[model samples]
Target chain A: MPGPGEFELIREYFTSRFQTGSRSGTADNGVELGIGDDCALLLPPAGKRLATSVDTLVADVHFPAGGDPYRIASRALRVNLSDLAAMNAEPLWFTLALTLPHSDPAWLEPFARGLAETAHEFGITLVGGDTTKGPLSITIQVTGACARPLRRDGASAGDIIYVSNQLGAAAAALPVVLGEVTVSPRQQQQAETAYYAPEPQFAVARAVEGYASAALDISDGLLADLGHICDASQLGAELNLDQLPVAVLAHSLQADAAVETALTGGDDYQLCFTVPARHRDAVQALQLPITPIGHLSEEPGIRCQWHGKPWQPRGTGYQHF
Target chain B: MPGPGEFELIREYFTSRFQTGSRSGTADNGVELGIGDDCALLLPPAGKRLATSVDTLVADVHFPAGGDPYRIASRALRVNLSDLAAMNAEPLWFTLALTLPHSDPAWLEPFARGLAETAHEFGITLVGGDTTKGPLSITIQVTGACARPLRRDGASAGDIIYVSNQLGAAAAALPVVLGEVTVSPRQQQQAETAYYAPEPQFAVARAVEGYASAALDISDGLLADLGHICDASQLGAELNLDQLPVAVLAHSLQADAAVETALTGGDDYQLCFTVPARHRDAVQALQLPITPIGHLSEEPGIRCQWHGKPWQPRGTGYQHF
Candidate 1:
């Protein structure tokens, strides 16, 4: 009920504290106007195209209610950055629209700190935003620049698919976070870290720009996300079950549970993409940490090959209905 | 519970429905890409600058909790558009971030229709956005273009002040909206119309460009908004209270209440600006419906005169604290 008002909150937590994330160190690095103006002014430089994405995280829906404020703030910003990363766009500027039930200083201080830290780390400037009184929610609109952004419909049949990092660690953390399971201190720490701060694959853009034909970050899980590419590209996929790069935490679980989680559970925030077979040598030579887990097929839907026998998984993936 | 999933929701409400707001009859006038894939792509034309602003309107805070979704959605987009008007930027495109308690079909159908109608009327496109499950709130981020945007810091001493339209109609409607008072049917309709759909003075940009020195739209009442300009420009204002333009509905009230509402109530959405004396003829020659309400001074705060006698208004303006 008691807290700083809107103007004071922005002054203390956002405006005076905005850090420029441009590497050029120039005052007018494309942001001719910011923060205090009626509208921020920007230019997309010459010859390059601009790509923009908007995402929202609601309390107790996308994240746990009353979770660590710092983790919540960091996760919100990082997930949007992951979207830009998937499109092979360089981070430029982002605007945050935050709704809060009240202006509690204790909650806002750490949230502001986390937001600043994450924005700086990702090299994205806080250009402008809105803070209003309401139930807690964070909505971010990000803008970036790139020549030819990766698209979902660019994949071709016979293209090899790749997945960044391992899957199921964040999913493994969910039960522990919801207090439905118990685990060792180390396991708990690992799962929590993976869940709270899934890294945006920033380097993948440069590594796969000219090589990967199609790409996107896995948010709703591998099966569902790949289904998106199949739907858009009008191509099917064949995944090798044994070849999946399972995270260490998932590997510790029962084999079936690990496999199921790896296939269906959400929140991985890793890139799942397809590259032409002809570019295999060039892609592998880039030496990035990615694994070939599957291949696009001329068939009309996803088909799994487990232990060299055709099989279907128990569920497709997480669905936000 | 029983509603469209995230993907279907987007397909129904956004992706399949984007249309051009461009007068050029070309699909790619300003939007390089829209409402598909991970992000929307946009570009500023040759020799133009981009302007952007984000605003949020919350249920119960900005409007009634169970208010008509059509009106609510319309008001939210219009208010943000007004900010672009103040900056003298042409309407381009906008992204919406909506949080809802659930996927209520009855609510969404009307909301989406209202959104599309208002967007078409304003000549803007729906680029991209996020829809999440949570408390009801609407956040809109608008990006536009202009050669040179008007700013709050450009007002000089001896500049004549102007208010785009009559004030206090929205304020007079508040008591009726809150059910604190009753008014004649005609008066209720007029006041409510003003409160819900306060027109953004879009003509001010072309009318005052190169003539007016400083500008901003009145959202937080006249005195408080004028204070903002003074604070930014390091100048003061002399307001002639008797000369203030009063809306018909406000004039229908008791004289004191009418003047009080006109002077102090918020939600006018009209442009308040300062024009140098030398350019006054050029500005008036534009033949816009604007009133000369005051003059700028070297002093540091606002001073008011009523019928040639010094007087004080009751309050500064609305504050969301």
Candidate 2:
């Protein structure tokens, strides 16, 4: 097979990966404008504010070295999108900074394909970016548009807390990193797929947009993440640990271990939120799979109840420092 | 002196550097509630659109090895800010992804101080970023706000051309890289300062906001960057090489060498713009040290006039690939 040069790589992977017909993507009439230009132009809707966030996935720190590039592209972009979702924003455009060891055609093909697939799924558009030669790293800065963004400081003391999707899939897959448990053929495929392709809760994010008082997508663990809410809102929470929606496989672990993993393990990509008690009915009417884990309080710090016993902070979550 | 630990180093150098007092900064309040949170909570101003751009500065590729860390931080942040300037935007916030060789407090102190100083200079605040252990590289994603952004596609065939400041300081500093010419005490200070601390033309960008038909900061060299405008606007340009503003020192070199350096050297953080002939007088009246180096043509490609002869393309600008 011919090696994928930069042009072909971008065309195949990034050109149509996100929603192409929108203001953020390539012009629908086939005008070739994107990362190739000095800058990418997006005709944003009138009166709407643009929300932006940037995150980097390093080789050894964010992802394991020599892992699948396709998965890396997918997870890296999705995690950034999750941030936009946390803001109740619609993903619009993104800029990618890719540092590669060398240009390998085999890696570029699948990687671009995965990136394209994820972008199409999210309705985002590729705007502008820089690619360089260096150690393996990918930094994606995503921009989204918000009608009304839910901020961290907006949570009142009486608001109820909620989370989207099950937590700890990526952390659960970390055994593949430590080699504590060997995967069987089927399990290897399942675990690896889950590890690489954890879904971003875009629909839930959109659903809870105006109704949410404060929201954040869980990239770090739930407890640590909720601590951000406490700090920002200057209030405390009493989380019902049993209410946490852990994955079925994770539930099989010992109670403490399951809680530990759910609380401290990172890379969940779920949305943790606070909503007023009055909006509970409206929130529940959305019919999303949400876990009402806790409620905001006048007190400061996190307190929990697990199996009717007092839940204690178990471990530190992912600390990049 | 005590060694800068990771936390204190971050607190002293990185955290305290950015000005959060302005609304464009993280929030009007001095505290960024999202620093240790799972995600940051940035309050985008109501009714205004957010503009963002990301660029990475690598060790060997972007900067010379053993280069001043303070200057590296300044240049890295300034380059990304230049993108915002091209859009006629005011920088609001930035997120940094720093990869370090080792935790050297001395290096980080200077580096952080430089980053902080630049951030304050632009009235931008550092909202949130990640620090990791890896090879030496810095990726900065800057977010700005645009009331009326000037895009590259806005230029027309009859627009007059202009550029702010001289070109090729970073490229001219290349002798320091090859070790062909030893940097003298004064030259070393100037060249190193130019190479490291590139001043983003924020004032020029703001001045040209409504007047410039199409505009972009000169990053990849004059000819190549002008080519971007031509391609975007579907037009060509005829540059007067005699009017090409070279710094006094640059003009001291041999004529051919000086022209070549001006045409091909990169890292010039000047603004290149086009204005309609009707507005030309008004633009020139700004008295901003701008030079009318060229005129846009209905034809398609860049041409330069020198000694009453058409000068061929001397060299291609910096190619990351």
Leading candidate by lDDT: 1
**Tens digit per residue, CA lDDT, model 1, B202-232:** 8877678888888998888899888888877
Q: Report the error of model 2 at residue B227, Å.
A: 2.3
Candidate 2 lDDT tens digits, A1-321: 434554455555565454343323436322124555334444555555556677778887788867777788888888888888787778877778888776676777777777877877887777666667789888887766667767777788989999887876667777764456785666566666657776677688788886888878777788878877877789999889888887654554334477678878788788899999999999999999898988999998888898999968657566555
Every model's DockQ, to 2 decimals?
0.73, 0.31
Error of 2 at B193 (Å): 2.7
> Residue B82 of model 2: what lDDT?
88
RMSD of each: 2.9, 4.7
DockQ of 1: 0.73
lDDT of 1 by residue, A1-321 (tens): 678877788888888788432322234448766687677777667777677899889888898877888888899988998888888888888898888888988988898889889988888878899888878889989988867788787889999999998998888788776667888888777877888899988797668989988899898889999999998888899999889988888877435588778888788889998999999999999888899998999887898888999978888777666
Instruction: Identify the CAPRI category of the predicted complex in candidate 1.
Output: medium
Question: What shift in Å separates residue B237 of candidate 1 from its native position after superposition?
Answer: 2.3
Top DockQ hit? 1
Q: Quote the positional error of residue A119 for candidate 1 in Å.
A: 1.3
